[model samples]
Target: MQRGLRSFIIIWIGQFASLFGSALTRFAITVWIYQKTGSATALTTGGFFAMAPTFLLLPIGGALADRLDRKKVMIAADLTGGLCTVFMLSLYLNGNLQIWHIYLTNVILSAVEAFQYPAFTAATAMIVPKEHFARVSGMRDLAGNASRIFAPLLAGALLAILDLSQFMIIDLITLSIALLTLTMVAIPKPTQTEESKRAQANLLQDVTYGFKFIWKRPSLVILQSILLTLNFLYTMGNMLIPAMILSRTNNNELILGSVQAVMSAGALAGGLLISIWGGSKRKIKTVLMAQVLTAIVGRVWFGLGYDTLSWLLPSFFVFFFIPISNGSTAAIWLAKTPPDVQGRVFATRRFAAQFCLPLSALLAGPLAERVFEPAMMPGGALASLFGNVLHTGVGAGISLMMLLSGIIGAAVSLLVYVIPLVWRVDEILPDHIAEPSSLIPEKTVDSDVGVKAPEGAASPAD
Candidate 1:
């Protein structure tokens, strides 16, 4: 293997370890907070603080990724995140840890991740061969799915034997591994284009350039819209799945865990398949069709099913297509956007796609508790009409919500797919060529404006 590819592999391994460690910490902290406070609001509040910063800071992080050494940026992010963990550990050991402290730590770590994410994403595009972009995206998804699959189990096991402080030391160790790997490899910088040079001239302009880049391409805007809509619908249903299952099963924790594990396994399996197959050549079609399947099979079928077997099978299919959809989308962006501007562009894409997640989360609970559940109860309004179909009761309202989200999501996806611009994105947009670059460029450009696609560059659509 070439040196750059080798470096990417090494970095990926380290990042996988780091991601697992972070997941473990998050799981443990969430459990701890719930145990101490016994308040669902507290748990949700912690999550909100953790996620809010990433959305707010992503554009700034993207700008910095373009301007700074990507390796150093990643290392700094890791170090900062590690220190936050360490701080929490110290507070726990001193018996002074509080819910507020955990929430504060989550905020800081999330802010750091805002920077870490874009740097790693842009660096992958920089170091890996363009042909391998889809494969690399699959690998990235695999790491995340693996973390989600195993972290809760591992953290629960460790929490049985160890306190929170001791558990956190493991996270510190993983962060060190990530730092070591980052130091060992050299990441190449993208060669400057005229647009980048001009964008870099003004700090404000640099920060906004990612948004402009996507806006200039009508296809990308529509794609973003589809993602945003799907994300909102998906998150709303996903947030309630556990409640739906637990309520129906009389708070069967084991069953809930089993369902979650199966979902993660499905995602992991999808990632593994994509890694091997590198997805279909028709990347946009893969993205849209996957959404349709995810909504129809995962959400719609899942909602219609009332038993364990019914839920488990559809749950697996729902998560299985998630990685495929996400991997294809990543491959699309990696191919279409120029390397010099990817940090900003990709960050912008992430911000747009995920902006509705928190909103959906916030809304799902109330809609279920106040509106859906009440309406689905026996003799409640609309209960008589849909009762025969969904079986009016505690969790039935959430199930109806899931069913509606799926129908709407599938309809939207199919609608978007038929639009000539969205489905034909791969044909309309040109892939950016990955060129060999020295460790340091002779001159650097900061702006991403008006960089023409490289000549003879192949489109993934072809």
Candidate 2:
């Protein structure tokens, strides 16, 4: 294997294992909580605590990724996060685990995650050539989707056969392997430039600098605006889908599971296809096309599904387009952003895109339960208008939300394409041409392999 790709593969393998174990633990904990409390509120609160800290701390994390050794950041995160899991295991083994205990552990893990993600994302750019950016993103997506597809089933089987604490133990073991792998690999450091040096003088200035970086670029601003709208609508739809499925299936867990599996399968397939194809040469086009396709297939067809097959078949297309869209968008950022600043920039972008998630989550339930549900009921307002197509039923309100959200999402996607700034974002943004000096050092190269070439000079893969 080429040296750069070799390093990436080693890191990817470790992360893949870590993701699988984390998924197992997550599934087990979610099930354990719901089974114990039988309250969605408790479950939701757990999720909120898990994500809130990470969301609030992302900017600081990005700053650290830019300033600190990426590998050390990852190692420290893993060690601390592993300790949280170990603590959970102890509580569970002693039969003293409380909901608050789980919440506290998740808070600690989230804090670790704020650092871990930026470090890992920045580290990836250090190891992977620019030409392979989309492919690498696809590979990462594949790992995540694989866990999503299989983890629940694995967790279910294990829960039936073994103790829940065992899952935490398994998680700790995977984390150890991940930490060990981090130790073996070497990540390239960014070449210190005058601007980077200036940015590092004050931590507060550095944290805010990420926001300014994106704000200063008109094309990026347009792209981010599009993403913000898209993610908000997307989250709203996601928040309602499960309830819609349950109502449609009469709370049939089997159908729900099958539908989820199909969606995961689609994402897995999409990631695999992107890895091979590397997407469009003009990556912005790839992103736009995927967005439009998903708005149509995912929002429209998904909303219009009247039966099990109708509901799930479109899901395959919905998820299939997501990775393509996300990978292409990531590729654009990877191509445009400086490696030294990628951590902060990427984190800022992520924060902006996801900032609306909690709000959407908070509103989705109320929107469905009170507004859409009541409005879709017999003799209620708009019942006559939508009831014929969507039907006045348990899931009908969710279906209505789906249809509306999809329509808005599609319209916004079309509007994005019409905007000249967003349409030509790739052309307008400057690509960062990396120097070999920022990557692997000559002394570190194997005598057999000789010196490593810089990413910019490396020939595209055959």
Candidate 3:
């Protein structure tokens, strides 16, 4: 392997390991909290605390990533965040653990992630060749899928065998491994630009610069809006999937697990495929195609599943398309944004992309209870139209909602694809062309900065 690619691999391995550990701890803590409180409101509150800090601190985190040594920033985030796990362990050991403690830990970890995400994302631009961006993104998604599959199973077993405190220790060990790998490899800094320099004078301006950058690009603005809308719809549909499954299967947990596993398998397959193939020359078109495929296969089939096979089959295809769309979109952003400014730009992207998710979460349950469920009940308004096909039952309303969400998602994808601004985003937005080393300018170097490889470490084109 090329030197830069080798380093990227090492970093990826460390992160993959650390993510599994973190996921296990997260699952354990969530289970612990729910068991202790037995209140959905408490659970929701914990989730809110966990996610809210990301929005609040993302811009500031992005600024730090741009201004500081990215590797050191990651190390610091890991160290501090791991300390929170240690604290939780101490609390659990002493029998003083409370729901509030878990909530606090979630918030603290979320704050740390605000710093970690931007730094890691920016660092990726430095290590991987532009041609490999989408592939690397697919690999990252694969790690996420692996973590989702691994963490819960491991956590469940560990919880039965040991305790939550022990799980926290595993997370700490993983963080240490990540820190070690970071120390062993150098992460290139983005070369300084005149604009980057001016923004450094005032952090607030740097933050605003991210917003301004996206706002000035109409194509990017349209793309961001599309993602935001999709996220909102996805969240709404997700909120009701469990209910649908339970109602259809007569509350069979085994069937629920099997269906979810099938979904993950589909995503795993997609990630593997994308990693090998990268994507089409027109990344935006690839993304749009994936989105349309997901809407039709995931939503429509998910809504129409009247039996186990039907649900399992369609959901596999649904998840199968997710990584293709997501990875391609990530590659487009990575290519368009200058590495130096990626931390800020990506933070802005994440912030805008996720802003509507909370609203969807808050409204989904109430809408199901007051409107959709009632409307789809036997002899209700929507029953005459959709009930016969979907059946009149507890989950009939959610099924209709899923069908509508799919139709809307497909319609939106088609609409966006036809819109010249979104359809031609890649062409309209110029790619950031600079040597990776130059992006990591000397001005940002410090004692902890990673050592660069020899000049010949990269291929000629790189």
lDDT for 339 (candidate 1): 81
Give the Å error, residue 74, model 2: 1.4
How are the candidates ranked when ordered by lDDT, highest leading?
A: 1, 3, 2
Model 3 TM-score relative to the real fold: 0.85
lDDT of 2 at 313: 84
What are the lDDT figures for the candidates, one per model?
Answer: 0.73, 0.71, 0.72
Off by over 4 Å in 2: 33-44, 94-100, 156-159, 243-254, 377-383, 436-462
Ranking, TM-score, top scorer first: 2, 1, 3
Q: Which residue pairs clash in candidate 2?
A: none
Q: Residue 435: error of model 1 in Å?
A: 1.4
Model 3, residue 259: what's the lDDT? 66
Compose the digit string of candidate 1's lDDT tens values, residues 1-462: 765566667666776777777767766776676557644346556656766788799888888888887766766776787789889999999999999998799789778867877777887776667777777677777666677677765666677677788778888887777666655556556878765776774667778999998899999888888878887877767766756776788655456556766777777787787777877898888888778888898779888877688787877776787767777888889888778887788778888777666667677777888888899999988699878888888888988988898899889888985699998998998877666322334244221111001000000111
Q: On lDDT, who's better, 2 or 3?
A: 3
- lDDT (Cα, 0-100) at 414 in candidate 3: 86
